[model samples]
Target: MILRFSQLIVGLILFGAGCAVMVDAGIGLDPWTVLAEGISKNTGIGIGWVVSITGFLVLLLWIPLRQKPGVGTVANILVVGAAMQFTLPLVSTPDHWIARVAMFIAGTALVGVASGIYIGARLGPGPRDGLMTGIHQRWGWPIWAGRLGVEATVLVTGWLLGGTVGLGTVLFAVLIGPMVHVSLPVFDGRARRRRHTTPAAAVGGLSAPGT
Candidate 1:
């Protein structure tokens, strides 16, 4: 329990810091971050604050979807943006385009790893993730369709609202799914345990709910 909680907190903090890195890169951002950035640009709010506020607002939408929040979900709302806020002021954009691209890639990779770690803790889905799943569960829409529709809306809206749209955004879109796919299994604690446990163990007396 202690280990899972620690992993969850650390992963969320890293995820926020990774976002700060990408923002400081100033090339382009993921769809959600682009939305946050666009709002921040227009409202003069810090991007991190926008992220937290947006998260809370998104969580409210869960009521209609009948989604239940978990410890990790609540922590995600509280911790990620604060960590980003703390980290952003410390990072500055690079002078060269190459360096900026590299920073964005690094940040994206960090976020991928962080996603695995926090999600592997098996506490709960983040609000945005839950929203996607809920859409599928309630309406029987495919997950990909729900994700694509929502993300495309956010991406286009954010672009219209003055968020950066460039190669980095394209790169993120192309790479993130694969990145998460690779990272998820590595950090998935339950899966890890399952892999290590023998078939004999499963049939012999150790069977339980998650097994």
Candidate 2:
């Protein structure tokens, strides 16, 4: 339990830092971050603050979907944006195109890894993911359909509002799923326990020998 909790916190912190890294890359951003950037640009608010607020607003939608928030859900709202705010100022946009591309790739990979780590902990779904699942629960919508509808809407809206939209967005969309797929089982607590359980250990736990 302690380890899972630790993984959750660390993963979320890394997730926010990864998002900041991508922002510093300035190539593009994920759908949610793009929207946050758009809102930040218009409101003169910090992008991180916008992210947290957006998460909170999304969570509210879950009420109608009959979704429940957990420790990880609440932690996600508070920690991720705070970490992004702290990390962003430390990173600057690189001058060279190659450097910027490399930075974006690294950031995307980091976000994928962070997603696996926190999700494997099984504490709760992030607000955006929960919203999609909630939509599924309420209306029997396919999760993919829900994700597509929401992301496409945000991406277009963000693009209209002056967020960067480019090759990085394309790369993130193509690569994140596979990356998370590889990382998830590696970090999953159940998988971890299964790996640690040797044949002898399993046998020892059974009532075999005379007591």
Candidate 3:
């Protein structure tokens, strides 16, 4: 239990730091961050606050979906944005394109690794992640379809609201799925044990053992 809790905290911190790294890379951001950025720009709130507020707002949506929040879910809503707030001041964008690109790639990879660590802890899904999975279960949609629909909607809305979108956006879209796919087993010990276990069982469901 201690180990799982540690993993969850570390993962959330790393995830937020990764988002900060990508933002500092000055290229683009993940879809959810893009929305946060847009909201921050429009509302005069700090981006970190926007992130936390967005998380809580998303959690509200979970009620109708009958989704239950766990310790990690609540922690996710608080810690991730706080980590980002702490990280952004310490990091800066490189002037060179190559360095910027490297930061973007590293950031994306860290986010994937973080996802594996926290999800493997089996506490609960983050607010946005819960929404995606809930949509999948409720509507009988493929997970990919649900993710794509949610992400695309946010991406477009963020763009319309004046968020930055660039080659990094394309790169993130192309790389994140595969990155998380490959990284999951490395962090998820239970998943590494079974060759045939579905990702849903390995990472997504509410029935996490020993949780």
Candidate 4:
């Protein structure tokens, strides 16, 4: 059930692409996006760089967890930040409420796609995702609890640094798991399906596949 490097790359790309679309929509972004917004404000190296930097830091959290930092780990380190920078300008929304809202919905869906792809790969773990897993193990908390704690910590830090936080952020917390859960199965290839047919699969309803 170990992930190959190709699967890892696909997952990272999905994760990264989702982030780009979500932000581009500008309705709101996921909790991690909120964190990135904060970093971008303080660093002023652009939002993209902040995302990359944060991803790198989060990935580091995995090493201490006894998780093997594989090609997927390396791919995550490079892809998200790079993908953010590369894709942001290419895809954007118009300056209207309707367009923005539609974009936001699309963005949320993209996040699901990204989550499904990356989590499906069952590669090591994205830095952000790794943070949640690390906290869960250390505190013996549920995935939701760990995720909320990790996200709240990041969101507050991001807010202190002036990252975007609003209804969109709230929406991400409330809805992202279902979206990811539903999408992964739809997008998964036959190989992935065979790999996923068994477990109950409900860590906040979005447990990473093959994990």
lDDT-better candidate, 2 vs 4: 2
Off by over 4 Å in 3: 196-211
Task: Give lDDT tens digits, candidate 4, residues 88-199.
Answer: 8889677987887677777777767777777666566666666777767866789888877777787787777777777677777777879877877654576565566445
Model 4 CA deviation exceeding 4 Å by range = 1-4, 63-65, 187-211
lDDT of each: 0.91, 0.92, 0.87, 0.71
Candidate 4: 10-residue stretch with minimal lDDT: 202-211
Tens-digit lDDT track for model 2 on 52-93? 999999999999899999999999999999999999999999
The candidate that achieves the highest lDDT relative to the unseen native structure: 2
- Order the numbered candidates by lDDT, best leading: 2, 1, 3, 4
lDDT of 3 by residue, 28-81 (tens): 888888888888889998787788999999999898888899989999999999
TM of each candidate vs. truth: 0.92, 0.91, 0.89, 0.79
Clashes of each: 0, 0, 0, 1
Consecutive 10-residue window with the lowest summed lDDT within model 1: 202-211
In angstroms, the error of model 3 at 110 is: 1.2
Better of 1 and 2 by TM-score: 1
